[model samples]
Target: MTFPKRFSNLPEYAFPRLRRLLDCHGPGGAPLRMSIGEPQHAFPPWVAGIIAEHAQEFGKYPPNDGTPELLSAISDWIARRYRVIVEPDSRISVLNGTREGLFNAALALCPEEKAGHRPVVLTPNPFYQVYSVAALAVAADPVYVPATAETGFLPDYGALAPDLLDRVAIAYLCSPSNPQGAVADKGYWADLLRLAEKHDFQVFADECYSEVYRDDPPAGALEVADEIGADPERVLVFHSLSKRSNLPGLRSGFCAGGPQSMSRIRQLRAYAGAPMPLPLQRVAEKVWADEAHVEENRRLYRRKYEIADEILGDVPGYRPPEAGFFLWLPVEDGEAAALETWRMTGVRVLPGAYLSREVAGENPGKGYIRVAMVAPEQELRHGLTRLRGCLFG
Candidate 1:
C-alpha cells in the first residue's frame, strides 16, 4: 500500500506532539490546563432549549448549504456585525465547523494552475494547520509567510515578489490569529484586498475570533473589501459559533463569499461535506441571532485579559494580545519553556513552535509559548501566576 506523499513531510498534529513531550513527566502540583483554546465559559442558557425543540429534526438529512432560517440568521448577523449584505440562499454555506469550510474552500476555489504555473497558497507562519494541508491536498505550493511581531503578527502578502504573487491562487488569513492573538486592522485588510485584486487571488479570512476582542470588534476582511469595492469573490470569510457562543462541541460555523465562489463551495459540499445536524443547526441559528450571550462571553474573556495583563505585565518581553484568547508569550525557547513550566507548576501550555512551520532556517514561533486564556477565571489566574513564576522568574 502506498501512502500519500503530500502529508509525508507534515509534523504530527500539535496535541499529539504535546502529549509526547509532557505526558511522561509528573506534574509538580495540581494540574491546571491552559493549553487548548476550548472555551470554558458557559454558553447561552437557551441553546439547549432550542436544540431540544428541534431534536426530532436530527432524523432528517440537513440541507447541504443551510436551512433558509439558519442562513437568514447568519446573514442577519453578518449585516449587523460587518454591515455587509450577503444573500443567505446563494452566498453562504453552513459548515460542520469553520475548519471544514476553511479546508474545503481551497479545494473548491483554488485553480490547478495560476498564470500558467502551479498555483500557490499563502498561509501565515503560525497558522491554523488546515491551511497548509489544504494547499497540499490540492497539490499547490504552500507558501508560509512570517507573521511575527515585526509584521504586526499579520502576513504581509503585499511585500512578496510579483512572481510569487502572480502564482497565488488563495491566501489564508486569520484575524485575531490563532496562536498570536493579533487582529488585522482595516488598513491591513484593504491593502491585502488590493494586492489580491492585482495578483488575481482569493483571500480566505478565518475570523473565528472576531467576537472575542477586548475593545471594538476586529475589522473583518469582508467588510473592508466591501468598503473598498473589491470584487465580492475576492474574500471568503469563515465564522463560527465555537468561540463566539462557547459551543466548540456543537461544531457549527458558516462561510460567506460571492455567489460564484459559494456556488463552487456548495457544489463540493453537496458531494463530500457533512452538514451540521438539523438540531445543531437550529442551535446555531439562534446563537447567531443573539448577541447578548456573545457580549457576556467577551466580558468573561475581557476579565481574563485583565488577569493576564495583571499577572504577566512585570515579566520581560510580555506583549499583551490585542484580541483573541491565547497569549503568545515570548520565551527563551518554546519547547524548553513548555516542559519547564509543566514540570515546575503543572500549568500546561503549548509550545509555539508546534503551531508554526520552519521556513528557511527559522521557525517564527520557536521562541514563544501559546497560553490559552480559556480556563475559568480563578483557575486561569492561578495558572498564569504559576507559569510566570516557573518560566519568567
Candidate 2:
C-alpha cells in the first residue's frame, strides 16, 4: 500500500511523541497531568436539558451550512463581541470545530498557484499543528516564522521580503496564541490587516482563546479590518465554544468573513464537510446566546492565572501570559526538562519543541515547556508548585 507523499515529512503528533517519551518511565511522585489544553471547568448545567429537548432532530440530516437559528445566534454573538455585523446566511459557516474549518477553508480559498508559482502559507513557529497540515493539504509552501520572546510571541509577517509576500496565499495567526498566550492588540491587528491588503493574501485568524484573557478583551481581526476598511474577505476569523464556554466536547465553532470567501467555504463544506448534528446545533444555538456561563468560566480561569503567577513569578524567564490558559515556561531544553519534571514530580507537561518546526537548524520552542492551567484551582496550584520545585529549584 502507498500513502500520499505530501504528508511524508510530517513529524509525529505532539501527544503521541510525548507518550513515547514519558510513558515507559515510572513517575517518581504522585501523578499530575498538565499537558493537554482540554478544559476541566464545568459547562453550563442547562446544556443537558437543551440537548435532550433537541434529541428528536438526530433522526434528520443537519443543514450543511447551519440551521437558521444557530447562524443568527452566532451572528448576534459576533455583533456583541466584536461589534461587527455579519449576515448569518452569507457571511458565516458553522464548523464542527475551528480545526476542521481552518483546514477546509484553505482548500476552498487557496489558489492552485500564486504569482504563477507555488503558493506560500505563513505560520508562526510554535503554532497549532493544524496550520502546517492545512498548508500542505493545499500544496502551498509552509513558511514557519519565529514567534519567540524577542518577537513578543507573535509572528512578524510584515518583515518578509516582497517577493515572498507576493506569493503568499494565506497567513494563519492565533491571537491569545496557544502555548505562549500572547494576545494581539488593536495596533497589531490593524498593521496585519494593512499588510494583508498590500500583499493580497487572506488572514486566517484563529481566535479560539479569545474569551479567556487577563485584562481587556483582545482586539479581533474582523473588528480591526472593519475599522481600517480592508476587504471584508481579507480576514477570516474562527472562534470556538471549547475555551469560551468550557465545551470542548461540544465541537461547536464558526468562521465568518466576506461573502465571496464564505461562499467558496460553504460550497466546499456542502460537498465534503461534516455538519454539526442537528441536536448539537440546537444546543450551540442556545449556548452562543448565553454569556452568563461564559463570564463565570472566565472568572475561574482568572483565579488560576493568579495562582500560576504567584507560584512561578520568581522563576527566571517566567512570563505570565497576557491571556489564555497555558504558561510557556522557559527551560534549558524542553524535552529534557519534561522528562526530568515527570520523573521527579510526576507533573506532566508538553515539550515546547514538539509544537514548533525546525527552521535554520533551530527550533524556537526547544528551550521551553508548555503548562496547561485547566485543572481545578487547588489541583492546578499543586501541579505548578511541584513543577516549580522540580524544574526551577
Candidate 3:
C-alpha cells in the first residue's frame, strides 16, 4: 500500500486520542462537558429572518470570494472594532470559518523554499492543530515554539536562533489564545510586527476568540500593524462570528490582510474555496453589522468569568483569564487531572497537553487542563465546582 509519507507521521486526531484515554471507564456522575469551546448561548434572533428572506439566492452559486454585502459587513466590523479600514473588495475574503482560512492562507503565501532551505512555519506548541497541518501540506518544516505560563502563554519568536528566523516563512499567533486565555496587548503585537519586519515573514493572527474577554478588549493585529506603519502585507488577521454571536454552526468568518496577499488567497480559493451560501452570507451580513448580540454574548461570558474566579480564586496558580471563555487551570499533570475529574465528577475537560505538541525539549501545556466556560450558567457553575473539587479540593 502506498501512502503519502508527509501525513504518515501525523499524530492521531485529538478527540480519538482522548476517547482512547478515557472511554474505557464510565463517567463517574452525570456528564458535564467542559471540553470543547463551542458556544452554547443564543444566536441573534435576526438570523432566521435573514436566512428566510435570502433563501431564494441559494439557487445560484455563491460568489467565490463572498458577496459585496457580506464583505462590506466584515469591513464595517473591522472599522468599528479595530479602527483599521480595509477595502472589502481587495483586502478581505469571507471564510467558511477561520480554520479554513488559516489553513489555506499558509498554502497560498508560504514560499516554496526560503534561503535555499525548507521554509519553517512557526507555531505555538499548544496551538490550533490546523497550523501544523497547513505547514505540512505545503511541505514546510513546522517549528513548534513554547507558549506557556513561563512566557505569559505567548510564543516569543525573538528567542529563536537567528539562523532559524532567517528561514521562517510564517508564524501563527492567537490572542486570548485557545486552551489558555492569555491576551496579547499592543506592545506584544508591536514587538511581533517588528520581528516580522526584520525577519521578512508574515504573521497569521487568529483572533477568533477576540470577542470573549473580561476587561478591556484585546488589541488586534491590524490595529497594531497600523500603529507600527508596517506594510499591510506583513500581517494577516482572521476573525469569526462563531464565538462572538454564538453561531458556530453558521460557519461564517473573514480573513483580511494586504491586497497582494489576499489576492493570492482569493485566486487559490476561486477554484478551491467553499463559499458561504448566499443565504448564509446574507445572514452573516446582518450578524456582523449588529453589535447587540455580541454585547449580550460578552455579558454572559463575563458572568462565567466571575463564577470561575469565585470558585477557583483561592487556589494557588489560579490565574483568571483576561480574555476568552476558557479556564486554563493549572493542574499537577493535565492527563491526570482530566482522568481524575472524569472519574470522580464526570466533568469532561480537555487536557491542555492534548492541544500541544512536544517541542524544543518541552510540552508547554503538560501541567494544565483547559476548561471551556461555554455551558449555560447553571451547568457551568456545576462543572466548575466539580473541577475545583476534583483538581484542587
Candidate 4:
C-alpha cells in the first residue's frame, strides 16, 4: 500500500527522535528532567472543587463555539491583558488547545493555491512542530527561516523574496518563543504587521508563554496590530491557559481574530472540533477571570529565572530571556551537550537543533540546548547546577 507523499519528507517528531537518541542511555546520577516544558507549579487549588460542582453538565453536549460564560471570561481576559476589547460572539473561539486552533486555522482558511502557484507557509526555525505540520497538512510549501543568535533568535520575514511573499498564505510566529524564549517587541510586531499588510498574508501569533516573564510583560501581537490599523482579519492570536494558569491538563485556550476570519474558523470547527466540556468551560471561565493564581505562578518562575542567571550567568553566550520558562543556552553542539549532560549528571535537556530544521545549510539552533524552567525551584537549582557542572565545567 502506498502512503501520502506529504508525510514522507517530514522528519520524525521531536520527542520520538529524542527517545531514539537518549532512551538507550542510563542516567549516571540522580535523574533530573529539564527537557520538556511541562509546568510543575501548583495549579489553582479551586479547580477540582469547581469541576466537581459542575460535573453534571458533562452528560450534555458542550456549546460548539463557546458557552456565554466561557466566552465572556475569555473576552474579559483579553481586555485585561492586551487592553483591546474583543466581542465574545464575534472575536473569540474556545479551542481544545491552541495547537488545535493553530493547525486547523490553516486548513479552514488557506486557499488551494496562491498567486497561481503552490502556497507557502512561513515558520521560524526552532518552532513548535505544529507549524510545519499544519503547512504540510494543507499541502502548502513550508519555508523554515533561521531564527538564530544573529537574528535576535527571531526570523526575519522581511528578507524573503517578494515572489515568495506573494505566495505566502500564512506565517506562524511565537513570541516569548518556544525553546528560545525570545519575545518579539512592539516594534517587531508593528513591522511584521506592516509586512503582512503589504504582502497580503495572515499572521498566526502563538502566545502561550505570554504570562511567564522576567520583568515587564511581553508585548502582544494584537496590541501592535491594533496600533498599526492593520486589517482586523490579518492577524489571529492564540493564547493558552496551559502555561499561564498552570493548567495544561485542562486543555483550554482561545483564538481571537477579525470577525470574518473567526467566523470561518468557527464554521470549520463546528464540523470537526470538539468543544470544551461544559463543566470544564465553567472552570476555565473562572480561571480566566482571576489573575491572582497567574501572578503566583509568575512569581515562582521568576525565582527559577534568578537561580538560573546566578548559576549560568558568567558562561559565554548565556542571555536570560525576557519572557517564557525555557532557557536557550549556547554551546559548541546542542546534541553533544545534551548527551554529555545526561550521561554525566542525569540532567536531560532538549537539544535546540531538535526543535528546529536546517535551512540554507545552517540549522538556526545547531549549537544550543533548551532547558525548561518549569520544574520546582529546588529541582531547577539541582538541574542547573548539574547541567553547569556536567556540560560547562
Candidate 5:
C-alpha cells in the first residue's frame, strides 16, 4: 500500500506527543489538567431546551450553507460586534468549526500556481496544525514564519522578501491566537490586508478567540479591511462558538468573506462538506443572538486572567495574555520544563514545541510551555501555584 507523500513530513500531533513524553512518569502530586485549551466554564443552561425543541430536525438534511435564520443571526452578531454590515447570503458559510473553514477555504481559494510557480501558503510558526495540513493538501509549499516575542507573537508576513511574497496564495493568521494568547490589533490587520492587496494573496483570519478577550475587544479583520477599503475577497475571517460560548461540542462556527471567495467555498462545501445538523444550527441561532450568556462567559475568563497575573506576574518573560485562555510561558526548554513540572507538581501542560515546526534547525517554541487556564477559579489557582513553584522555583 502507498500513501501520499504530501503529509509524509508532518510531525505527530501535539496531544499524543505530550502523552508519549509524559505517560511513563508517575506524578508527584494530585494531577491537574492545564494542557488542552478545552473550556471548563458553563455553557448556557438554555442550550439543552433549544436542542430538545429542535430534535425532530435531525431526520432532515441540513442547509449546505446555513439556514437563513442562522446566517442572519451570525450577521447580526457581526454587525453588533464589529460595526460592519455583511450580507449573510453571499458573504458567509456556516462551519462545523473554525478548523473546517481554515482548512477548506484554502482548498476553495488557493490557485494551482502563483507567479507561474507552485503557490506558497504562509503560516505562523507554532501555528494551528490544520493550516499546514491544508497547504500540503493542495500541494503548495508551507512556509513557516516565526511568531516570537520579537514579532509580538503574530507572524510578520510583511517582512518576507518580495520574491517570496509574490509566490504566496494565502496567509493564515490567528488573532487572540491559540497557545500564545496574543491579540492582533487594528494596525496589524490593516497592514496584513494591505500586504495581501499588493502581493495578490488572500488572508485567512482565524479569529476564534475574538470573544475570549479582556478590556477592549480585539480589532477584527472585517472592520479593518472595510476601513482600509481593500478587496473584500482578500480576507476570510473564521469565528467559532467553541471559544466564544463554551460550546466546543456544539461545533458551530462561520466563515465570512467576499462574494466570489464565499461562492467557491460554498460550492466546494455543497459537494464535500458535511452540513451542520439542523438541531445544532437552531441552537446556534439563539447562541449567536444572545450576548447575555457571552457576557457572563467573558466575566469568568476575566477572573481566570486575574488569577494568572497574580500567580505568574513575577516570572521573567511572562507576558500576560491579552485574550484567549492559554498562557505561553518561556522556559529553558519546553519538554524538560513540562516533565519536571509534572513529576514535581503533577500539573499537566503542553510543551510549546509540539505546536511549532523547525525551520533552519530551530523551533521557536522549543523554549516555552503552553498552559491552558480553563479550570474553575480555585483549581486554576492551585495549578498555577504548583506550576510556578515547580518550574520557576
Candidate 6:
C-alpha cells in the first residue's frame, strides 16, 4: 500500500542516516561517539533507588494526568524555574515524554484550515524533526524558517508575510535550540507571543533543553507569556527529565498551558496516550522536587562548555552554543566533515544537514556538523581535539 503523500517527502531520521553515511567506512582509530545528543553524564544515583522502591507499582495503571504529588512537584519546579504559576489540575498533562506531547499536540490542536485555506505550521529549519512530522501528520503546511547564524540561531517567524502569519495555526519553537544551542531571551519570546496573538496561532514551546545550560537560565515562553498578559491558551510549554535529569530512557516529560487547551489535549491523550507507569510517576515526583541533582547536572555541562570553548574557541566561524549540550561546528561541508572525522580520527558526529530542510535550494545546515558534548571530560577533550584536527586542520 502507498503511504500517505504528506509523509512522502519526509527526510530520513538523523541517527539512521548518520549510520548509513559512516558505517560503511571503518574507524581509523579507537571509536568515540559524540554524534547523537544522548547524555553520558550521571543521572542522580537516587533515581534508580526510587525506581526500585516503586517497582511494585509498575503493574498498576498510571494516573491519566498525573499523581497529585507529581503534579505538585512539577508546579513547584515551574514556579521556581520560570516564575510562572500554574494550577496543576486545570493546566498540566503529565506526558510519557516530551516527544509524545510534541507530536500529539498537532494532532489534537491543528484545525482543518486557517484563514479559509490550508493551515501553516512554522518550525526552525534545522529543528527537532518531530515539529515537521507533527505538522504533516495533521495535514498542515509545514513552513521551515531558517534558524541560522544570521538569525541568532532562532527562526524569525516575524519576517514572514503578514498573510502567511494569518494562516499559521501553530508555531514550534525550541529554546536552547537543538544543534545550535541558542537560547531565546525574554524579549524574543514576548515578540513571538505578540505575533501569535496578532496572527491567531498557537505556540508550542519546546524547552526540553532548558536545564542543560551554564549560567542564567533561558527565558521560558510561558514565563514571558504570563508577564506580558498573553492569553494562556496561546502557548503550550513542554519540558522533560530527559535532558534536565539525564534520564532519557526514563521517558518522562510534561505539557502545560491553559485549562481549555489542556482539556482538549488530555481528551485526545485519554484515547491515544501512554500514561507514565505508576512506578515511574512516583519516581518523577521525587525527581522533580529535587534541585541539587539538577544543579550538579548543570555543573557538568558547564565544564564541558569551558572545554569546548578552550578547544574550538579560535576556530573561524565557531559560535559557542549559548546553552544545551550540542556543539554546532562550522565546516565547508557537514557530510564531508563527519565522514572524514570518523574515518581519520574515529570520532563520530552528525552532519548538520540531517537536522535541516532545504527550502529554495538552500539547506541551512549544509555547512555544519553537530557534535554532542555528552562524552566524559577527558574522552570528550580527546574526541574534540581529534575532530578539530581531522575536519579543520
Give per-residue CA lDDT, model 5, range 128-158, as digits (tens).
9999999999999999999999999999999
lDDT per prediction? Answer: 0.92, 0.95, 0.91, 0.91, 0.94, 0.93
lDDT of 3 by residue, 80-135 (tens): 99999999999999999999999999989999998789999999889999999999
Encode model 6's per-residue lDDT on 1-393: one tens digit a residue.
877898988889999999999999999899999998888888888888888898999888888888999999999999998888999899999998899999998999999999999999999989999999999999999999999999999999999999999999999999989989999999999999999999999999999999888789899999999999999999999999998998899889999998989999999999999888988888899899988988998998999999999999999999888899999998999999899999998999999999999999999999999999999999999998998888777
Q: What are the per-model numbers of colliding residue pairs?
A: 0, 0, 0, 0, 0, 0
- Native-referenced Cα lDDT, model 2: 0.95
- Judged by whole-model lDDT over C-alpha atoms, candidate 5 comes out at 0.94
Q: Which ten residues in a row have the lowest lDDT in candidate 3?
A: 357-366
Candidate 1, number of clashes: 0
lDDT value, residue 211 of candidate 2: 95
RMSD of 4: 0.9
Candidate 1, residues 61-134, lDDT tens digits: the string is 98888889999999999999989999999989999889999999999998989989999999999999999999
lDDT order of candidates, best first? 2, 5, 6, 1, 3, 4
Report the lDDT tens digits of candidate 2 across residue range 195-254: 988989999999999999988899999999998899998999999999999999999999
Give the worst 10-residue stretch by lDDT in candidate 5: 176-185
List candidate 4 stretches off by more than 4 Å.
Answer: none
TM-score for each predicted model, relative to the true structure: 0.99, 0.99, 0.98, 0.99, 0.99, 0.99
- On lDDT, the stronger of 1 and 3 is 1
Residue-level lDDT for 110 in candidate 3: 98
Of 2 and 6, the candidate ahead on lDDT is 2
- Misplaced by over 4 Å in model 1 are none
